[model samples]
Target: MTLEYLDYTIVFLSLGSSIAIGVYYGFFNKSKTSEDYMFGNRQMKVLPIAISLVASQINPLTIIGFPSEIFVFGITFGFHFIGMIFVVLILIYLIIPIFYENNITNCYDYIEKRFDRRTMIFLKTLFFILGYLYIPVYSYISSQALSFVTTGINVHLINTIVCSICVMYTMLGGLKAVVWTDVLQNFVMFFALLFITYIGVTEVGSFKETFSRASDIGIFEVNTNLDITSKNTIWNCFLSGVLLFTCLIGFNQSCVQRIVSLPTIKDSRKAIILFFIGFIITVSIVCILAVVMAAFFNDCDPLKSGEINQSDNILSYFVQKLSINTRGIQGMYMACVVCASLSTISANINSLSCTLYKDCIKPFIPNSKNNNLIPKIIALLSGVFLICSGFVVEILNSTAIQIITTSLNLVFSTYASTFMLGFLAPRIHSRAMFLSNIVGFIVILGVIVKGQFFSGRVQYEPIEKTFSTDC
Candidate 1:
C-alpha cells in the first residue's frame, strides 16, 4: 500500500478503536444510576483509578506545552516539580481522607455541607468557569498538534473531530470507559515520550554534550531567583506552583473524581501516593525530552525557522523532525498525539457531565423530573459542550492561549483556600467559603482586566521567542 494510504488507514483504525471501546462500555456495561457513571460505581480498583488520574491531568498540553517550556527555558522548568511534591504529600495526608470518609459525589457538595448552600453554588460556578476556560486551551493545543502531521488541515475541523470522539466515549460510556481507555492511552503516551527522547538525544549526541550546549546558551542554570512578575523564575515557580498544583492535585474536580472511584478511602489514598511517584517520572521525563529538543534543534532557532510562530508547535516540530527518517513513525507519533489529546478531553467530558448532572441538575430537579430528565440532559449537554469547545478552539489565537492558561491557573488557585477549608476545617463559615470563591475569582479577573485594559500588554511573547534575534 502507498504511504499516504497506510497513514490514513492507521489513523482511522486507531480512532475507530476508541469509538468501539466507548460503545462497548456505554451500551453493554453502563451503570444503572448517575453515581456509577460519575464514579465508576465507587468500586474502582486502585491501579485503574491511579492510571486515569495521571492520564487525565497530564494531557496534550503536557506532551506539547511542558516540553515546549523546557525547550525554551531548559532545566529551570524542572523546579516546578519541587512544589508539586509538597502538594501531593499534603493531599495524601490531609485532603483525600475527607472525601473518602464523606462518600462525596461532588467536592463542592462538601463545601455546602461544611459551609453553606450559597458557598457550594459559588465554588461550583467558579470551578465550572475555570474548567471550561482552561480545558479549551488544551483542546486548541491538541488541534494544533494534529496540524503538525497533517500540514494543511483546518484546526477547527480537527478540534471538532477530536472533541466529538471525546464526547461520545464520555457521554456514552461515562467514567468507566474514560478510565479504561486512559489506562491504554497512558502507556501509549509514556512510551511515545520515551521513544522521542531517546531518538532526540541520540540524534544530538551524548547527554554531557547536550547539557554543555545548554549551559553555554545559559539555559541550563537552576535559576533560583525570585520574580513574581515573571513566569518561570525559581522562586515564582515554587510559590505559585504550590498553589497551582495544590488545586490540581487536592481539589480539582478531575483528580478528585478519580480518587473517589476507589473501593475505599485507603485505596484512594494509595492511588494518590502512586500518582506522586508517576508524576515525578512524568516531570523528569518531559523535562529531559525538552532539554534534548533544545540541544537537537537549538541551532534551528524555531523563530528563525518560523516554527516558533506558536509556542505549542515546538514539540511537534521536534517530533516531526525526529520521526522523518522512519517509515511510519510519523504516523505512530501522530497517533500518540491524538491519543494524548483525546484521553484528557474524554476524561473532562465525563467529569463535566458528572459535575453538571450530580452537582447542578440533580440538585434542583424534582424526583420525577430527575428520573425523566437527568440522564438525557447529561448526554445531550455533554455533546453540546464538546462540539462548542471544538468551534471555540478555532478562534483561540496566541494571545488567547496565554490568557486562558494563565487565567484558569489563577482561578483554580482560589480553590486552595476554599476546598482546603471545607475539607479540613469545616468550622469555617459558609459565608467565608462563599466570600472566598467570589474574592478569588475577582482577584484573577482583576489581574486580567487590569492588565488588558489599564496596564500595557504583559508582553508574553512565546517562550522560545525570548531569544529571538530581533529581541
Candidate 2:
C-alpha cells in the first residue's frame, strides 16, 4: 500500500513523540549516576516495565514472521503457549531471584560472582560481539518494512533515519527514556493490530466463517507426532519452546536488565507475571489475525497469485490491498513495524552499553567516578555502528555470507546452557563450564557445515491458485 501524506504524518508523529520523550528525560530529569542511566536507579514501577518487556521482546520479525507461519503452516505453532508457561514458571522460581538478590546491573555479572572473572570475561566478549552483529539485522529488517510502505524512500536512508532517532533518545534519556517510549509504542502496536484485525474480520463477513474457511483447508490441525525431528509437533513445541525462552528471557542481557530494573525482587517478579499475561494476549491476537488473513485470502492467496515474493510479504500485501480505500491504515502498520524494531534496538543498545561498561571497561578503571557520560557515548557509537552495518548487510546479501553469519549466531546459543550450568550447578567447576562452552561451539559449527554442504535444500509445497470473480 502506498502511504499518502496523512499516513506519513501519523508515522512521523509516533516517531517524533518517542524522541521528544528522550529529550524531556535527558534534559529535565537527567540521570545523575551510571546506576540511574543503566538501571533507572532501580526505582521503576512494574506496569510500564511489563509493557516495555513485551514491546522489546516482540521484534519486527515476530510481528511479521509469526503471522506468516500461521498463514502458511497452521495453528500448531500456537502450542508454544504451553512452553511459554513452563519457561515463565522457571524464570520466577529459579532464575530471577538470583540476579535480583545480588542487585546486579548486567546478567553476566552473575556469572562472575558464581564462577570466576575469566568465565565472565569469556561470555561477555561473546555477548558483546553477538549483540553488535544482531543489531544490524534488526535495522535491516526495520528498513525492509519501511521500504514496503514508502517505495519512494531508499531502504538504507530509512535505516539511517530510524537508527539516528533511536540513538538520540537512548543516548540522551538512557534506560528510562527507552522504557517510557516503549510503553507508548506498545499501545500503537496493539492498536494497529486490533484495527487491522477488525477490518479483516468485517471484510470476511464473520469470525465463524473465517475459521470455517481455515478449517476447510486443514489449518486447525495440531501435530501430535512423536518424532523428535518433526517440526511443530506437540513434544517439539513444548521442549524447544522451553529451551528457547530459557535462553532468550533467562540469559539474555536485554531481558534481564528490564527485570532487575524494578525496585525489589517482588516487583520484578510481578512485572514478569504481567509481561507474560500481556505477551500471551498480544500473541493470541496476532494468531487470530493470521486466521482472519487466511480467510480473507482463501481464494486470492498472494504467494500463489505472485502478488508477493515471500510469505513475510503477506502482511504487507494484505495491508496494501485493504488500504485501497482505507487511507492511514498502511501508515499505522508501518509505524507498528518500526515501533517494534525501535523498541528492541534501543533496549539492546542500552543493555549492550551497560554490559560493556560493567564487564569490559570498569574493571580496569577502578577509581573512576559513577559518571553517565561514558555509557551514553558508548551507546551513541554503538548505534552509529549498527547503522553502518546495515549498509553492509544490504550490500552483501548473499547465501554464503548468510550461512557464515547464521553459524556464528548459533554459537551464542551456548549462553543458555552455560547460564543454566552456572545458576543450577554452582558446584560444577568453572573450568568445565568454560570448556563445555568451547565444545558446544565446535559441535554447532560442525553441524552448520554439514547442513550447508550435505543436507538437501528444503522444498515447500506451493499454494494452489484460485481466482474469485467477486474481486
Work out the TM-score per prediction. 0.90, 0.93
Clashes of each: 0, 0
Model 1 residue-pair collision total = 0
lDDT of 1 by residue, 1-471 (tens): 123655666567678888888899878976676667677778889888888878876777777777777666556667777887788778888787777677776787777778788877776787777767666777777777787677888887888787778777766777788888888777777776777777777788888887766656556666665656665777876776788778776777877888878877789778987877777787688888877876776565674667558667877776667666645555666777788788877776667667777766676776633142355466557656756776665664444446565666666766677776666674777676677678777888778766667335555333432242431
Q: What CA RMSD would candidate 2 show?
A: 2.6
Assess the local accuracy of residue 117 in candidate 2 as a C-alpha lDDT between 0 and 100: 79
Screening candidate 2 with a backbone cut-off below 3 angstroms (N, C-alpha, C), the clashing residue pairs are: none
lDDT, model 1: 0.71
Query: Model 2 scores what on Cα lDDT?
Result: 0.81
Error (Å) of candidate 1 at residue 394 is 3.4
lDDT of 2 by residue, 152-233 (tens): 7998899999999999999999889999999999999999988888888888889899888877666677778797656467
